[model samples]
Target: MTASKLYILDTNVLLHDPKCLYEFKEQDIAIPMTVLEELDDIKDRKKNVSSEARHAIRAIDHILSGASTSAQITKGVPIKQNALNGVDTRLGKLSIFPDHELTMRQGFLPNDHNKDNLIINCALHLQATNPHREIILVTKDINMRLKALGAGLLKVEDYRTDQLVSDIELLPAGHYQMEGNFWEHVTDVKSYQEGKYTFHQIDRSILPNTYPAEYIYDESDGFAARVISVDEETITLQDLNHERIMQQNCWGIEPINIQQAFAMQAVLDPSIDLAILNGAAGSGKTLVALACALEMVIEDKQFNKIIVTRSTPPVAEDIGFLPGTEEEKMTPWLSAIHDNLEAMHEQDERPQSSVKYAIEKANIQFKSLNFIRGRSIQDALVLIDEAQNLTPSQLKTIITRCGKGSKMICLGNLAQIDSNYLTPLTSGLTYIVERFKDYPGAANVHLEGIFRSELAEYAEEHL
Candidate 1:
């Protein structure tokens, strides 16, 4: 097959999604030797991305395994489309560009011991060698793309294979607010009662973009309901008592706002398997999630244990260097959870003792995101904090570990993503919110209005 374009992948692109090799259908892919060297160096590191680097290396090795000679390796190997998701199309070729051998030329980017410059030089060499074909340099690094474009490489682009949404605003908020009374928008409605709960079957046109577990609320009428099911013709919504939901206490924590109430309701619900809560910092995502988790595990006896894990930036490299057990090492990163627990029991005469009692009674276990792979967690509430820093693939690795009777609560602040490679639109939190909106078992609630303090609310808005 005649390849349409020659795509040169940067190391970060492969690290972002190792399986991205098969994503560019019918187009040839060229990996620079520098990228391989970087992956080799990163694979042995004590970092979160080390696993991703290993996966990327394995993917490249699998594709090039069938190559018989160096000439065949450089020339390219056909990507086996049959093994990839049953895709029957004529796939493209995968080639390893020997950028190390490229001679520095006039007007070309000076290598300067920089891997990015070498990769750019490879694209330039490829463009010169394959004059008639399109050569595009794909990198997840914004500055790398800019540098590639400045170095006379044409068609520089960011890796968009795992990017689910083009705009962060397009992401689902897990709830919709109507302009006026929600009842006024319904043209046809059939109300029914089952097991003391009221459900209304409304025409699909009432909320065309609605999805399961998304709440519909009208402030004017003081009404709210959760979408239970959606069909082509109609949508079934279960009536929610707004006052009751707001008044419900979870381990001495009450919802301060309607969005928080919706999030707490989702977390406390027995039917929901995955509840995602995202918002600005100090929006009480962790507090509410932890409170509900404690309520279920300690008071309600809905689960056997509470396993809390979050993406720790420093823990990636320094976790082993810290003294004490895994949970003790994770305490600094998970301090917010402890603060929430303390706040929950602060009103008691012996707050510290109460916090200790709750921890022991609920079997709260602090875990690291890196060590959670390949283990099945059953009959527990898995609370993932700072989820925006995780990639979709990494989140999948953790999410798939959930066994029977496990509930996952993901808390994130999209505005506060600290990962250099991740954006709000590409965050695993955003990915799952969009991917699972249609599923009946999951719910996402974007909490608004910071309730931490007056200063926090002002900072969230102005700063």
Candidate 2:
């Protein structure tokens, strides 16, 4: 029989996903004393990290509480699969490794009191003592994993339990291109007309797993349509009336490309409550979102007001503390919002001061995401900028707060996530784009063309 491997987890692995303890089935799991210390320090932090830390500590405490004695915990306790609501079922032993003489014998530098190095020392001690079993250090920090391998630990890996995709390129762009001869494949179809749109029903077998609001285009024929309904037998598509809408100005701004036009249509539709726009740095994700929101709140009178929020992340180093109200502190992070509003005002041929006047009269609100809990926003256009920095849990909280008659628009560039724990594949923006793709009231667009400026586009491409 093959011996089970011993996996030593870092504090980041726990904070990234609190349920990671049960992911390693039938393998011995070790938690270093240094990791517990780190969790204790982080348990009181704000937002997702604190919630994850507290949940992880509680899970560990729950397991230890059922143990017969403290010595039983030291000797290793069996992690039953039935504990976590019966989702995981692997009989593995869990033990907390104390900082002992074995760790000191590893000969790490006495002055290197960093938590990462101390965790590596614990894994090294386990490898030295247990010759028959393999020991691996599982960490989410890339630099820590590299440091462990450089320190002569042969087994090291990243925690990938929460990653939805192995590569960012594999994520769906929410659209598909049909061949020039696409109409030749359709047979036994039903047709009808509603307003300016011509609806067609084709067999669902032709496009398996096709989702509502997904765009399909044929370049050669200059034909485009969006899936409106999906049934077990057939899918209904509505011909895109791009000519009229594409030429119409949205709040004095025009879409520069076909993708942007599609985004405008999705945002203007009152039936669709959720819209996501993702793109490169200069792809106008924020501009289109802000324009549509202003039009909805001011020109159309469809929504009561506009609420804007975004993640606050420093560029290089922490700026310590700012003295002011919540909105004053958020001004530094929301410069893009201010810039886009000013540009819209200029396009409307209004005086510069009118931007502030319009915002105040229209009841536009700038909110910090930190205080969004327990409040239901009704009949509002809620715009979440820089959404890539949010975790799935944070995104869920924001989405669930949308009350009746409210719509949400998420704008972000996946390449520019600033959160230390989030990545393109595991970000909250990506999560919603994938999960809500098939929902009838949700639509997504990936804008490609850069409309900010020639210099900005050049920098985005080359640098």
Clashes of each: 0, 0
RMSD of each: 1.9, 2.9
What is the lDDT, from 0 to 100, of the residue 254 in candidate 2? 91
lDDT of 1: 0.89
The list of candidate 1 runs beyond 4 A from truth reads 86-90, 315-320
Highest TM-score against the true fold, candidate: 1
Could you give me the TM-score of model 1 versus the true structure?
Answer: 0.96
Off by over 4 Å in 2: 1-3, 45-48, 67-69, 77-91, 100-103, 106-111, 181-188, 194-197, 205-209, 231-233, 347-350
Q: How would you encode candidate 2's per-residue C-alpha lDDT over 425-444 as one tens digit per residue? A: 88888889888977989989
Tens-digit lDDT track of model 1 for 1-463: 5697999999888888889998998899999999999999999986678899999999888889999899999999988876566755557999998899988988579879988888889998988888889999998889988887887887999888777788999998999999878777877789999997899999998889998999989968478899999999999999987778879898788989899999999998888999999999888899999889988998889999999998877634554567889899889989888898898888899999999999999999999877899999999999998899898988999999999999999999888888877888888888898899789999999999877899988988997
